[model samples]
Target: MIRAADIQDGRLRGDEPRRIDPRVHEANRRSRLETGDVVVVLVGRVGEAALVEAEFHHWNASRTVAVIRTREPDEAAWLNLWLGSPAVRAWCERQATASTLQRTLSVTALRKLPVPIPPAGLRAHLLRAMRLLEEKAATNARITECAMQLSDAHFAREASDGTPWPERPLASLVHITAGTAPRPRPDHDGAMSEPGTAFVAPADILQSTSPHLYATERRLPRGKEGRVCAPGSLLVASREDGVRAVMNHVPAAIGRNVLALEPESVSDAHWLLHELRSRSAEMAATAQGSAGRELSRKAFAATAVSWPPQEVREQFARLAGRLRERARIAENESERLRELRGRLLDGFLSGTFPKGPLPDDQGVQPEGGLALSGPQGIS
Candidate 1:
């Protein structure tokens, strides 16, 4: 089974290949993936999906996956982003069938889902904006990778030196806390949650490969839930033994199965987050429980972390901080661009975008050989 975790890194990352029976591969000719197809999970985690690249066209998809073939390349790009949007995800949740085992979506239902397809002229503007925003995000990802490499190199150098750094139990420097237990689910027609105050879950923290949060789905009225996590506190997943950590950019009501690390002494929160990433193996080893792997407060507080001299730790933090700050700026810029793109898309698809047809001479040609012109002239 190709579970959601396989591509939870925000893309299909594995390079391993598997053999398939020719008979099984040919059985679903109609659904066979082609280059640039967008594959979505049809069963558990229905909205979890990714844009398939040319290299994966030869590979077959499991039945849990659904393939979306767009009429135009631009449309495929639009669909990929749209499918990941909060609006679309909410719709999927409402339509999904839930059982004791898991939730699943049907192809027929997905096909019938309404989408506001824009006219050619406005679509061209949308595609232009989409390309620019996506490029910016890709740039930030590259920068983040570089920052991670630098951090790893520093740790490697420290490890090479003789005499390990003095270690201290995590409780000595930081307080370990878990989130408020989730209340019972509201009746289908009743509202159990509200927006504005973010209610963060394990999956939300895991979405970012870095030690920071970019997005989430759960939210509540301000202060509705206990264990309110302020910006800069580190968070780790406790549900199903998910082993990832991140720092919040805003105050959020912590959800069940999430642990928050609050700095109480000299240990810097940012440095602590990176250190936690380095000791993930030890954290995983302390995972407790059976039905769902739970890391108890006792286990969390007992985690031993290296404590280097204050001056050395501060120096390292200063160097690493510069790289992280630069990457953070790029990430923030890209996030803002994505939000703007979503708004523009919503307007264009709804026929509310301030534009009508433009003169032939004023038309702008997109890279795809299509010209898009309007009252706004593709602004």
Candidate 2:
């Protein structure tokens, strides 16, 4: 039999049958699930289903609803596909009881749901396609992991000493510049539409992996020469919040809270970026002001930073470039696959596609896994 506890442990990850807890389970202490069982959510946004792939035993369920066990085991995957379809999702949405906290589905409502049974061959093809997508996702995850490892190795090698390297004042290495917002005027339309410029505010600079500028409503076409940021220039946020924000990857027109740094002698933009990220917390803490924290250009220019040799800096940059490229590729692929999955679900459940019949036998039993509880607060 299926049990609510099995679903809680993620045993129904893919095409697996699931057992949801029944109110009667509380008193009997007996599992309510069986092999090839499917758990259908009744309350709180219905139409979510889980197929039971392995046998397990447990009790208890709160917001969850009814359990369905098919006579055939092989048909579980096809059932899962049907359940995840947009048509089914829409049906569930209609049945949901709207409340202030959430939408709920009742167990009785789930049993009467209708599903179309598709041709076996078509169902098999869809399952194969899903498997391929899963494989691609796994591959993308591996690529991202490798890229992270490469970055870690490079950084570890450069910062081995646990202390700042022999260095120079930041002012000596680069020219620091700032940008301004034009005073708001009555006649001037607030929309910025002209080309050849992108404006970046302190909010844009914060939480970016590389320097980037998104389009803004305000623009200054005439003041294009105020602060030009090229690919290798280091852009930092000058506001107290800017000190903690990292530049997203892209050239942006500077906002009032940002500072643009153009390297004077050697090309060590990557090194500088890394150093700034490492020091951001400290810098933000030391920022001066009562109402809003601000980082003065003069104070920042006066700070000293230890620099590694030119060769080391260049090597790190090259390695980082390769890793970042791979990361970008993986990220793009992941997004595409996710979109594909969504579309596939839409087609599969709408009765537009067919699926195979259920199997005659049950699947294997699962091993005991780790237990996860509710969130814990820090002491």
Candidate 3:
């Protein structure tokens, strides 16, 4: 059965249903999804919506999700896009009620969502354009996935099958240090305020597109830059699981429970990153502590890491680098397509989209032509 996480960014995305027990799902056949049907999340973290593309046609959803079948099947795509729009999201939030820690949209409230029904012919251009862009973005995502898989395979092959190389202590390759957390200052309104300096925590680096240091929600006031990690340094989390390593591409101050490593060999930074990622599971196994897994400076320094020959390192670097670069580019294009879809919603719903053979100013028109079919997944 479908769960909230299976519905990603306005698209139903799971290789298989979350619950595939034929006994349970078959009993709820009335709610079984069909192609072009839309699923809107109703309980906890509400307002997330997705279209049931053909791939998920045989699936059924949990009660936490509500399915809607539009009057005109072709308009289902538009509804999905609209549900993901900022206006719709805001409206859903206002309509939601809090129960304990979970916030949800009631069936009654969800049913009343305002839907603008554009002339069927008028939507053809916008729908076709979106479908074409989705296909392009999906193709990019698939290629990126393939490239990353190939890179991982080659890395594993070289590590286990290639000629053996000497192992080296991590301490020999990099200098590691801990970060400090600055206390927040209280404002006149009695709320704690951030220091202007971009103070980072383990959580911020978790979703970074590139392995680079990006600005995060945490910050220190102007003066405390003491525990700073400059660009090219590696920021590692103290904990064993989740996002463990991020290359601080920009100069940023780090908070407590994090370690910053500066590689002795500058050019080896990216290669080191790949090696660490490949060995993430191993690193977790060796971490210290029963209460909460923590990686200490001493433990980290003592850890034995592969020191493959220069040629082997170079080969891995080239392969991983190309894959990462391609993935980054593909992800960026996907973001752009999302932006274009949002623009279409703003224009079409607001009656601003050009009526004739699409205007050059809009930059998105079906004139280039399209064959609408399915949803897309991003990297």
Candidate 4:
């Protein structure tokens, strides 16, 4: 089933959604999603929306997600675009009923959402402009996905190669530092802002589409830059789903739920990252708690980890680091494309766009062209 976390970054995450037997719900069932349906989060993180594509045509959504069946594909697409705007998100937040646990958006409030209807021609033009930016962003996402897949493949091949590698306890090779929660922000507004160290929570790691993180949804206050992991340090955390890890490109304040894994030798950063990534399932199996959501430091430290020869480690790092760097470049480009897309949408909806035909694909390119050439090594 699609959960609030599944709809992120204006799109439905590709991770498999929970499914039910075909006998329980058919394609014609009201609960089943249609191709053009728009799914909106009804509980926490209200207003987060995603368009149901052909891949999930007959899939079922949980009660936490509300399905809006539009008259046609265009209408559904239009609604999805509008729902992502800042104004609509703020309006959703305002309409939602607050509780000590979480906020809930009632169906009545969703029905009252203000929708603007423009002429067919104008709507088509707006959609075309938005579609162009979206396609570019999707392409960038694929580029990063390919780069990461290649890196993982390389590591897998090297690890399985008939080379002897000693297995050692994780604590012997890395210094484990447990993260502490930062002091609550004085403003009391739980929104992400700039000019502070990136505060990483477990959700940040689980929700990230890429293995590298440049920012997070929360930031520590100026004086509260608690336990920080260096740029290349491996930040790991676990939940019921399993263990998740990411390399922070900037100095990040770690949340109590996160654990920063700093390698004893600086050069082992990439090697350690890939090693942990490849064995995420194994490490997750050692996690404590009934739901496997809690990873004990003592247990994690005692876990057995493979230790390859220096030359082998260097070889893997050299190859994997280059692939990771390429992935970072693609991810950065995708981020810029999202920003540009948001600006375009904001302008179009606010009537600030130019009074002529929308810009062509050629005119929408950011300062640098959207293409890459040489591969670079990760620092």
lDDT of each: 0.64, 0.55, 0.67, 0.73
- Per-residue lDDT tens digits of candidate 4, residues 1-379? 5666688877887574655666655542556676877888877678899898888766777666777886667777878887888777878877887664456787667777877755456667778988988898888788888988887788888889987788998889888887886633423233444678888777778777777888875677766785678888888888765688888888888876678888865447777777778887777876778877667889888988778888888887888778878877877888787677778877765666546764341232112111111111011
Give the worst 10-residue stretch by lDDT in candidate 4: 370-379
The 10-residue segment of model 1 with minimum total lDDT is 370-379
Candidate number of the best TM-score: 4
Deviation from native of the Cα of residue 26 in model 2, angstroms:
29
Q: Compared with the true structure, what per-residue lDDT tens digits does model 3 show for residues 266-373?
A: 446766776776876677654566623455778777888878777777777777777777777877788788888788778875667756544333343432211222
Identify the candidate with maximal lDDT: 4
Clashes of each: 0, 28, 4, 1
Could you tell me the C-alpha RMSD of candidate 4 in Å?
8.8
2 versus 4: better lDDT goes to: 4
- For candidate 2, the per-residue lDDT at 182 reads 35
What candidate 1 gets wrong by more than 4 Å, as runs, is: 5-33, 41-49, 58-65, 70-75, 81-90, 97-106, 116-125, 183-196, 238-242, 265-267, 289-292, 350-379
Task: Report the candidate with higher lDDT, 1 versus 2.
Answer: 1
Which residue pairs overlap in candidate 4's backbone?
1-18
Candidate 1 residue-wise lDDT at 187 = 34
- Which residues of candidate 3, in runs, are more than 4 Å off? 15-22, 26-32, 41-46, 60-66, 93-109, 168-269, 276-304, 357-379
Ranking by TM-score: 4, 1, 3, 2
| lDDT for 370 (candidate 3) | 18
- The ten-residue window of minimal lDDT in model 2 covers 370-379
